[model samples]
Target: MKDLIKAINGHLAAEFQASHTYLAMSIWLRKKDLAGFSSYMLAKSNEERGHASRMIAYLVDSDETVELPT
Candidate 1:
């Protein structure tokens, strides 16, 4: 269970990083006046955030220690 939690936390970190990267890309696109691309990237970033949330919720519900990644 501890190992599982650790793996899940690692995955969550990856998802968070992905979200951050997507957001940065979206902002850059918007600055370049590419509204469509920017919107798409923004949506992807939101989806990644949702994925991270679900992982955290699962950990909490499973009675596991939720150690947030740095």
Candidate 2:
């Protein structure tokens, strides 16, 4: 269970990193006047964030410690 929790936390961290990357891309696209692409990237970022949120909820429901990544 500890190992599983560790692995899940690692994946959660990756999800957050992906979200940040997408948000940066979205901002860059908007700056370049690509409204459609920017919106798409923004949606992707939101989706990644939602995934992370779900992971967090799962850990809490399982009564496991959630060690947030740095």
Candidate 3:
């Protein structure tokens, strides 16, 4: 169970990083006047955040203590 929790936490971290990168890309594209690309990146960023949220909810539902990354 600890291992499972650790794995989920790792995945959560990756999702957060991906979301951050996508958000940056979205902003950059928007500044470049590429609305379509920017929208696509924004959507991807939202999806990554959703994935992270789902993992957090799962951990909570399992009654596991969530050790947030510092």
Index of the highest-TM-score prediction: 2
| Predicted candidate 3 versus true structure: per-residue lDDT over 2-42, tens digit per residue | 89899998888889999999999999999999999999999
Q: Provide the overall lDDT of each model, using Cα atoms, as 2-decimal numbers.
A: 0.93, 0.95, 0.91
Off by over 4 Å in 1: none
Tens digit of lDDT per residue, candidate 2, span 32-70?
A: 999999999999999999999999999999999887877
CA lDDT, candidate 1, residue 23: 100
* Candidate 2 similarity to native, TM-score: 0.95
TM-score to true structure, per model:
0.93, 0.95, 0.93
Candidate 3 wrong stretches, greater than 4 Å = none
Residue 24, model 1, lDDT: 100
lDDT of 1: 0.93
> Which of the two candidates, 2 or 3, achieves a greater TM-score against the reference?
2
- Per residue, candidate 1 scores C-alpha lDDT tens digits across 1-70 of 7788899988998999999999999999999999999999999999999999999999999988777767
Candidate 3 residue 66 Cα shift, in angstroms, is 1.9
RMSD of each: 0.9, 0.7, 1.0
Rate residue 46 of model 2 by lDDT: 100
On a 0 to 1 TM-score scale, where does candidate 3 land against the true structure? 0.93
How far residue 64's Cα lies from its native spot in candidate 1, in Å, is 1.3
Candidate 1, TM-score vs. the true structure? 0.93
